[model samples]
Target: MNDSEKISILSKLISFKSVNGHEKAIAEYLQELLNKYGIESEIVPVSDDRADLVAEIGSGTPVLAVSGHMDVVDVELANWKTDPFTMTEIDGKLYGRGSTDMKSGLAALVIALIELKQSNTPINGTIRLLATAGEEVGQAGAELLQKKGYMENVDTLLIGEPSGYRAVYANKGELDITIKSKGKAAHSSMPALGNNAVQHLINVLNKIQASIKGYMDIKNDVLGGTVFNIDVINGGTQPNAIPGSAEAVLNIRTIPEFDNKKIIDLIQSEIDQYNNSTNGNISMEIGMEIIAIIGNVNSKIIDLIKTIAQPYMSKIKYTPEQIKVAEKQSELTGMPFSTTEIKTMGVSGGTDASKFLIDQPNNANYVVFGPGENNAHQDNEYVTKEMYFDFIEIYKKIFVEFFK
Candidate 1:
C-alpha cells in the first residue's frame, strides 16, 4: 500500500470507538480488512463486546508476531480540537484519539504484512498480526491470548506502542493497590465525636510518600526507580458526617530490581508501621499486579531490531516548534530527543509486551517500537504523517532482514 492508502486505513481504524471495554467493532473491521488481502484470521473472544484478532502469514519454527492493542483510553470529547473519532490532518500531523496512542501503528503493521504477502516473497518463518482488546484497561486480551496458548510458538514479539522512533527494551512494572482506612461516623455538629477516616487516610498517604522517597534512592539506569501515584480516593457519605470508611487507589511502577510482590511487601511494611502507631484500623490490598520486564539485550531479535533501525535513527529529527509541542512527551518518556539520540529508553508505563514476556520468558523476545510521538493517553494526540509512512518501510525492512 502507498502512503495515502496507509493513512486511509488508519483513518478508518480511528473511526471506531473501541474504548477500553468496547473493542468488537474495531476488531471486526480489522478482520474484514485482512480478509480483503485473503488473510485468514481468528477472532478470539475476550468478553461480550471485546475480542482479539490474530492473523498469520507464512509458517515455520521461529514465528514472529507483530502486535498492537485495539482498545484506546476513553476520550473526553469536550476537550478535543477535532472529533476524537475523526482522523484529521493539519501541518503534516494527523490528529485523532488513537492516531498516536496506537491506531497508526496498528494500520502500519497490517499494511506492512499485506504488502509482504503481495510481494510473493518466500519467507522462511511466520509473521503474525495480533490485535488485542482491553489494553487500555489491564491487557486482558493479551493475558487471555497467553492463557489460550496463542503465544506458544512465537519466537519474537514486536509491540506497536507509541515510542517516538525509539525501540524500547525495558519498562517499569505496575501494581494497583487499594488501601482502606476505617473509623467511626458521627454528626457534623458533634465535636470530636467520631474518628475522621478521611484524615486517617491522608495520614497514611503522607507516610507512604515519605517512605517512597527513601525507596527512590534505589534506581536503575534503564528502568529507573519505583514510582507511586494515588489515582483515586473516596470517603465520607455526607459533608455533615465523619466517614466510617475511606479508600485510596495507588499505582506503583517499579523496576526489575523489585517485583510486584516485593513492592507490595514494601507498602505493607509502611502500612504495618502506621497501623501499629494508630488504633490499627488501616489496611491495604493488591488490586492489580503486572510484572516489570527487562529484555535480553543479547537476544538475536534485539540486535536485529537495532540494526534495522540504525539507518533510520538519523532520519528522526524534530522541528523547533515540533520539539516545543512535544515537551511534555519528552519529559514523560525521559527521551530528550531534541539533543539525544533516539535509542532504547524505559517506557514510563506498562504495555501488552509484558504479558507476552511474562509467560515465555526464555524463548520469546519482546520489543516495543513504533512511529508515533509520545501523545499516548494525552489530549490532542497525533502521529506525524512522515513517521507513519516511514514505519511501513521500517517494519517491511525488519521482515526482509529477519527472513533473509
Candidate 2:
C-alpha cells in the first residue's frame, strides 16, 4: 500500500471516537475493508456496544495473530492544536489523538494483510488480524477474547502497541489498592469529642509510602524493580464537621520476580499496623486489586525475530555499551532499545498483551511492537509519519518471512 492510502485509513480511523468500549464504528469500517480483501472475520462483542474484530486469512495450528487496539484515550479538544479526532498533517507529523498511540498500528496491520494477499504468499499457518477494543480501559476486549478461547490455537501473537519499532517482550504487572479509614464525626467546635478520618488516612499513607520503599529492594534482571504511586485519593465530606471517612488509591507496578500476593499482604499489614498504633477509635479497610500482564520472552520467538532483524541490524540505534556487548552476541538482548528482540524482562506499564497472556496463559507466544512516541496516555500525543510507514514494511516482512 502507498503512503497516501495508509494516511487515509489512519485519518478515517481517528475520525471515529472509538474510545475504549465505544468501538462499533471502527469495527464496522474494518469489517468492510477486510471483506473487500476476501478475508473472513468474526466479531467478539463486549458489553457497551464495543467489539473486537478478528480476521483470519489462513487456517491451522501455529497461527500468527497480528493485533492492535481499536481504542484511544479520552481527549480534550481545547488542548489540541487542531481537532483531536481530525487527522492533520504539519511538516512530517500526523496530528490526531490516536494517530501515534495506535490507530496507525491498526492501519499498518490492515495494510500488511492487504499486501500479503496481493503477494499470494503461501503460509503453513493461519494469519489472524485482531483489532481489540477497550485497551485504554483495562484491556477488556483482549480479556474477553481470551475468555472466549480466541487464542486457543495461536502460536505467535504480535500486539501493535506504540513501541517505536522495538519489540517489547516484558512489561510490569499492576496492582491497584484502595485504603479506606473511618472515624466518628462531630461538630468542629468540639474537636476533642470528634475523630478525624482524614488525619488517620494521612498516617496510613505515610506508612504505605515507606512500605513501597522497602518493596523496591526486590528486583530481577529483566524487570528491574517495582514502582509505586498514589494516583488517586478521596475522602471526607464538607470542610467543616470533622470528616468521617477518607480513602487513598495506590498504583503499584511489580516486577516478574516478586510474588504479587506477597506485595499485597505487605501493604495490608502496613495499614493494619498503622491502625493499631493510633489510639483513636478509627477503623481501616484495605482492598487490593491486581491487573497484571505477563512479562516473559519465549526463546524460540526471540531467536526467530532476531534472525529476521539481522539484515537491518545496522539500522538499529543502540547505546555504546550495548553495541559493544551485543555486537557478537547471538541471543536477543533485553535492553530497552532492542526492539527487534523478544524481551525476558518486565516493565511498569500495562498493555493489551497482559490481558491476552492472562486469558491464554500457555496458548500463544506473544510480544508487543509498534511505532509512535512512548508518551502514551499523556498530553500532546503524536507519532511520526516516517515511523508509521516504517512499521508497515517491517510487519509485512515479518509476516511473509515467518509464515511463508
Candidate 3:
C-alpha cells in the first residue's frame, strides 16, 4: 500500500471522534474497513458505546498482537490549530486528536495488515489486530479482554502508543488512591466548637508526602523511581461553614517492586502515627483502588524490537520539514533527536502494555512503539507524515519477519 492510501485510512479513523467511552462507532467502522479487504473482525462490546475490534490474519500458537486503542482523549476544540476530529495534513504533519496519541499508529497497523493479506505472505503464526477502547481512561477494554480469556494464548504484544521512534520497554505502574478525612461540623462563628475537615485533609496529605519522600521511597533501574501527585482535593460546603468531610485523590506511579499492599501499608502506618500523635477529631479512610499494574524491562519483545529498529537507526534521514519540527521540539525539551532514528527508552506513565504483561508470565513480551511525539493529552497534537509512513513500513517488516 502506498502512503496516500495509508493517510486516507488514518484520516477516516480520525474523523470518528471516538473519544474515551465512545468507541463503538469507530469499532464498527474498522470492522467495515476490514470487511472490504475480506478480513473478518469481532467487535467485543465493552459498553453501550465502547467496544474492541479483534481480527486475525493467520493461524497458530505464537501470536503477535498489534494493539492500539480506538479511543482518544477529549479535545479542547478552541485550543487546537485545526479541527481536532478532522485529520488535517499541513506542512508534512497530520494534525488531529488521536493522530499522534494513537490513531496514526492504528492506521499504520491496519494498512500493514491489509497489505500483508494482499501479498499472501506465508506465516507460521497469527497476527492479531486488537483495537481496544478506554485506554485514555484506564485500559478497561484490555482488562476486559484478559478477563474473557482473549489473550490466553498470545505470545507477544505490541502497543502502538505514540513514542516517536523509540521502543518503550518499561512503564511504571500506577495506583490511584483516594483518602477521605472525617470531622464534626459546627458553626463557623465559633472556631473552637467546629472541627474543620479540610485542615485534617491537609495534615494527612502533608504526612503522606513526607512518607513518600522518605521511608516509602523505592527505585528501579529501568523505570526510575516511584512518585505520587495529589491531583484532586475536595472538601467543604461553603466558605463560611465548617467542613465535615474532605477527600484527596492521589496518583502514584510505582516501580515493579512496589506492590499495592506495600504502598497501602506505608500509608496506613503514616495514618496510624498521625492519629496517635494528634488528639483531634480527625480520621482518614482509603477509597477504591483504581489502577494497579506492573511492566517488564527484559522481555523477548524488547529484543525483537531492537533487531528490527537497529537497522533503521543510523540509516534513515529526515526531511527538512521533519528536521525543523524535531528541532523545535528538541529545543523545547532540551533533548536533541536530530540524529536519532530509533532508540530504546522507558516511560514514566502507564499503558495497556501493563495489562497484557502483568499476570501472563509465559506470554508477557510487551513493547510500546509508534510514530508520533509524546503529545497525547496536549494541544495541537500531530504526527509527522514521513515517520507515520515509516512506522507502517517497519510494522510490515516486523510482521513478515516474526510471522515467517
Candidate 4:
C-alpha cells in the first residue's frame, strides 16, 4: 500500500471517538477493514460499548502478534490548534487525537498485516493482530483476552505504543489504590456527636505516606522502583455537616522491585494497624493493577529488531542490554528527526502487555516498537508522515524476516 492509502486508514480510525468507554465502533471498523483484505477477525465484547479484536493469518506456534489498544483518551477541544479528530497535515506532522498516542501505530500495523498477506510469502508462524479496548482507563479487555487464551503460543509480540522508530522494551507498571474511610455524620455545631470520615481519611493518608516514604531510595535498574501520586479524592457534601465517607485514589508507577503486590501488602499492613490502633473504619481496595517486568535483554525478538534496525541507524547508541533500539532516520541517507516535542512527552503508565503476558512463557518476548511521537495524552497529538510510512515498511520487513 502507498503512503496516502495508509494515512487514509489512520484518518478513518481517528474519526471514531473510541474513548475509554467507546471502543466497539472502532473495533467493528477494523474488523471490516481486515475483511476487505480477506483477513477475518473476531470482535469479543468487552462491554456494552467496548470490544477486543483478534485477527489471524498463517499458522502454528511461535506466533507473532501486533497488538495495541483501539481506544484513545478524551480530547480537550479548546486546546487544539485544529480539530482533534480530523486528520490535518501542517508541515509534515499529521495532527489528530490518537495520531501519536496509538491510532497511527495501529494503522501501520494493520496495513503491514494486509500487505504481508498480499505478498503471499511463507510465514512459518502465525501473525495475529490483537487490538484491545479500555487500555486508557482500565485493563478489563486485556484481562478478558488473556482468559480467552489469546496470548497462548505467541513467541513475539509487538505493541503499537508511541516510540517513534525506536524500540522501548521496558516501562513502569501502574497500580491504582482507593482507600475508603467511613464514619458517622453529624452537624458541625455538635462537638463530639459524630466521627468525621474526612478526618479518618487524613489519618489513613498519613499512615500510607509514612509507610511508603522510603520506597524509591532503593530503586529498580530500569524505570525506578515506585513513583506515586494521588489522582482523585471524594469526600464531604456540605460545610455544615461532618462527612460520612471519603475515598482517595492513588496511582503508583511500579517496577519489579517495588511491585504491585508488595505495595498493596504494605498499604494493607498500614490499614490493619490503623484499624487495630484507633478502631478506624478505613479500608483499601485496588482500583486496577498493571504488572511490571524488565524486558528480556537477550530475547530473539529484540535481537531481530536490532538486526533489521541496524541498517537504518545513522548515529546509534543502542546495545543488547539497552531498550531504545535506534534513532529515527530518513530513507537510507538519514536526517535528524525532530524529537523536541517528544522529549517533553510523558510515558504511558503501562501498556496492555502488562496484563496480556500474564501466564505466558518467560521466554515469550515483546517490544513496544512503533511509529509516532510520545505525546500520548497531550493536546494536539501528532505523528510525522515520514515516521508513519517508514514504520509500515519496517513492520512489513520484520514480519517477513522473523520466519526466515
Candidate 5:
C-alpha cells in the first residue's frame, strides 16, 4: 500500500473516539475492513459498549497473533492545535489521540494484512490479528479474551504497543496500595481532646518509605529498578475540627524479582512497627492490590523475537542478562513480585501483552511492538508518517516470515 493510502486509513481510524472501554464503533469498523479482505473476523464483545475484534487469515499450528489495543486514553480537545480525535498532518507528523500510542500500529497491521492477502502468501501457520479494547482501563478486554479461551491455541503473541521499532519482551508489573488510618475526632479548640488520624497516617507513611529503601534498588538492567509514588491521598472533610480519617494511595511499579505479596508484607510490617512505636490512640488499615504485568523473560520467546528482529537488532545499554539477574535477586530477597517468563526490551510501560502472555494457555512467544511516544499519556500525542509506514513494513515482514 502507498503512503497516501496508509495516511487515509489512519485518518479515518483517528476520527473515531474509541476511548478505552468505549471501543465498539472502531471494533466494528475494523471488522468490516477485515471482512472486505476476506479475512474471517469476529467481534468478541466484552460488554455492551466494549468489544475486541479477532481476525484470522490462515489456520494451522504455531499461530502468530498480531495484536493492538482498540482504545485511546482520554484526551482534552482544548489543548490540541487540531481536534484530538481528528487526524492532522502537519509537516511530517500525524497528530491524533491514538496516532502514535497505537492507532498507527493498528493501521500498519491492517495494511500488512491487506498486502499479505494480495500477494497470495503461502504459510504453514495461522496469522491472527487481535484488536482488543479497554487496555487503558484495566486490560479488561484482554482479560475477557483470555477468559473466553482465545489465547489457548496461539503459539506466539505480539502486542502493538509503541516500542520505537524495538522488540519489548518484558514489562514491569504494578501494585496499587491504599493505606488508611483512623482516629477519634473532637473540637480543635482542645488540643488534647481528641486524636488526629492524619498525623498518624503521615507517620506510618514516612516509616514505610524509610523501611522500603532496600526494595527500591536499581539493580535490574532491563527493568532498571522498583519505583513507588503516592499518587493520590484523601481523608479530611474540613479544616476546623481534628480529622478522624486519612489515607494515601500508592502506585508501585515492581521489577520481576520482587513478589507483590512480599512487598505488601513489608508495608504491613512497617505499619505495625509504626503503630507499636507510637503510644497515640490511632488505628491503621492497609489494603494492597497487585497488578502483575509482563516481566521476566521466557527463553523460547526471546529466541523467537530475536530471530524476527535479527536484521534490526543493535547493541543497547540494558541486556536481558541484567534483567534476569534483577528478577532472580528480587525473588531470592523475598519481596512481593510477579515475573513474566518472556522478556521484552525497550519497554517502560504496561500493555495487554502482559495478560495475553501470562494468562494464555500455551507458553506463547510474545513481544510488544508499535509506534508512539515514551510518555504516551502526556499531551500533544503525535506520530510521524515515516514511523507509521516503517511499522507497516515491519509488520509485513514479520507476518510473512512467521507464517512461512
Candidate 6:
C-alpha cells in the first residue's frame, strides 16, 4: 500500500470516537477493512461497546504476532486546537487523539499484513495482529484473548505502543489495589458514638507510609522504579454524618526484581498487621495487575529490531519536556551530533503485554515499537508522518526477515 492509502486507513480509524469505553465500532471498521482484501478475521468481544480484532495470514511455524491497543485515552476538547477525532496532517505530524498513542501503529500493521497477503509471498509461518481493547484502562481485551489461548503458540510478540520508533525490550508493570474501611456512622453532634471510617482509613494510610518503603528503594537498570501513588481516596460525604464506608486506591509500577505478586504480598501483609494490632476494619482487593515485560538483551529479534530502526531514528526528533523539581537531580544534556545510535531502551509505562504473561504463554519475546509521541494523554497528541510511514516499512521488512 502507498502512503496515501496508509493515511486514509488511519483517518477512518481515528474518525471513530473510540474514547476509552467505546472500541466496538473501530473493531468493526477493521473487520471490514480486512474483508476488502479477502483477509479473514474474528472480532473478539470484550464488552458491549468494546471488542478486539484478531486477523491472521499464512500457515505454519515460528509465528510472529503483532499486538496493539485499540482504545485511546479520553480527550479534552478545550485542550485541543483541532477536532481530536479528525486525523489532520500539518507540517508532517498527524494530529489526533489516537494518532500517536497508537492508531498509526495499528494502521501500519494492517497495511503491511494486507500488502503481504496480496503479494502472494510463499508462506512458511503465521503472522497475526491482535488489536486489543481496554489497554488504557486494565487490559481486559488482552486478558480475554490470552485466556482463549490467542498468545499460546506465538513465537514473538511486538507491542505497537508509541515508542518514537524505538525497540523497547522492557517496561514497568502496574498493580492497582483498592483498600476499603468499614465503621459505624452517627450524627456529628454525637461524635463519641460513631467509629469513623475516614479515621480508620487514615490510620491504614499512616501504616503504609511509615512501614512500606514500596519501590522507593528498589530500582531497575533500564526501567527505573519509584512509582508508588495513592491515586484515589474517598470517605465521608455529608458533613453532618460520620462516614460508615471509605475506600482508597494505590498504583504501583513494578520491575523484574520487584513484581506485582510481591508488591501485593507486601500490601496484604501490611493490612494484616494493621488489622491484628488495632482491629482496623480495612480490606483490600486488586483492581488490576499488569506484569512487567523484559526480553533477553541477547535475543536475535532485539538485534534485528534495533538494526531495522537505525535509519529512521535520525528522522525522529521528539523529546518530552522535563519537569524541574526542587530535589537535586542530574543536569540536562543534549545528544551527540551525527551519532548512529539506535533507539533501543526501556519504558517506564505499562502495556497489555503484562496481561498476556499471566499464564506464562510461550517464550514469546515481547518488544514495544511504534510511532508514538511522549505527549500521550495530553492535548494535541500526534505522530510524525516519518515515524508512521517508516514503521510500515519496518514492519514489512521485519516480517520478511523473520519468515525467511
Candidate with the greatest TM-score versus the true structure: 1
Among all windows of ten consecutive residues in candidate 6, which has the lowest summed lDDT? 326-335
lDDT tens per residue, model 4, 1-404: 77678889999999888877788998899999999989999999998998999999889867888898888889999999999989999998999999987998889889989998888877888998899998887678888998899887777778888876555566678888999999889999993788899988999898888778877686765554577788889999999999989999999888777778889999999999988988469998887788774566566666776676545543334464333322422222122233222111123358888788866413347788777764778999999887788778778888888877
| lDDT per residue as tens, model 6, 1-404 | 77788889999988888777788888889999999998999999998899999999988887888988888888879989989999988998899989987888899889988988889866689998899999998899999999999988988788888876456777778888899999888998896788799988998887775555745777777777647779999999899998889999988777878777777777788889878887458999998778777765555667778777787766654343322320112221111122246555666678888887665522347788777766688899888887788888888888887777
lDDT for each of the candidates?
A: 0.81, 0.73, 0.77, 0.79, 0.72, 0.80
What are the clash counts of all predictions, listed in order?
Answer: 0, 4, 0, 0, 23, 1
Model 2 earns a TM-score of: 0.85
lDDT score of residue 222 within candidate 1: 76
> In candidate 6, which residue ranges exceed 4 Å CA deviation?
187-189, 238-241, 317-339, 359-364
| Superposition-based RMSD of candidate 2 using all C-alpha atoms, in angstroms | 4.9
The 10 consecutive residues of candidate 4 with the worst lDDT sum are 338-347
Model 5 TM-score relative to the real fold: 0.80
TM-score of 4: 0.87
Candidate 1 per-residue lDDT over residues 1-404, each given as its tens digit: 66677888999999888877678788788889889988899999998999899999988867888899988888888888998889999999999989988998898899988998888767789998889998776788889988888788887788888876666777777888999999988998883888888988999899888877777778877787887899999999888998878999999897766667777777788889888888637998876677787776566666776777666766766588877767765776575554344466666688887676776443346788887875688888999898888888888888877776
Instruction: Provide the RMSD of all predictions against the true structure, rounded to 1 decimal.
Output: 2.5, 4.9, 3.6, 6.0, 7.0, 3.7
Once model 6 is optimally superposed onto the true structure by TM-score, how far is the C-alpha of residue 214 displaced, in angstroms? Answer: 6.1
Report the C-alpha lDDT of model 5 over 224-250, residue by residue, as the tens digit. 677778888776677788887788887
Q: Kindly indicate the candidate among 1 and 3 with the higher lDDT.
A: 1
Residue-level lDDT of model 2, residues 1-404, one tens digit each, is 57788889999998998765579778889999888877778877787789889898766766888899888888776777888888988887888889877898889888888878877877667888889888765677888888888877777778788765445676667776777778778888886787888888888788778877876787766556777888888777776788777778777777656656777778777766776778433343434333445534654455555566445544656678765665444233234445354334444567777777765433246677777765566556777777787778777778867665
Q: How much is 344 displaced in model 1, in angstroms?
A: 1.8
The digit string of per-residue lDDT tens for model 3 on 13-83 reads: 88987877788888888899899988899999998889998999988868988899988888887888899
TM agreement with the true structure for every prediction: 0.91, 0.85, 0.87, 0.87, 0.80, 0.88
User: Which residue pairs clash within candidate 6?
Assistant: 162-372
| Residue 397 local lDDT, model 1 | 85
Which candidate should be chosen as best, given lDDT against the real structure? Answer: 1
Instruction: Report the poorest 10 consecutive residues by lDDT, candidate 1.
Output: 333-342
Model 1 clashing-pair count:
0
Winner of 1 and 2 under lDDT = 1
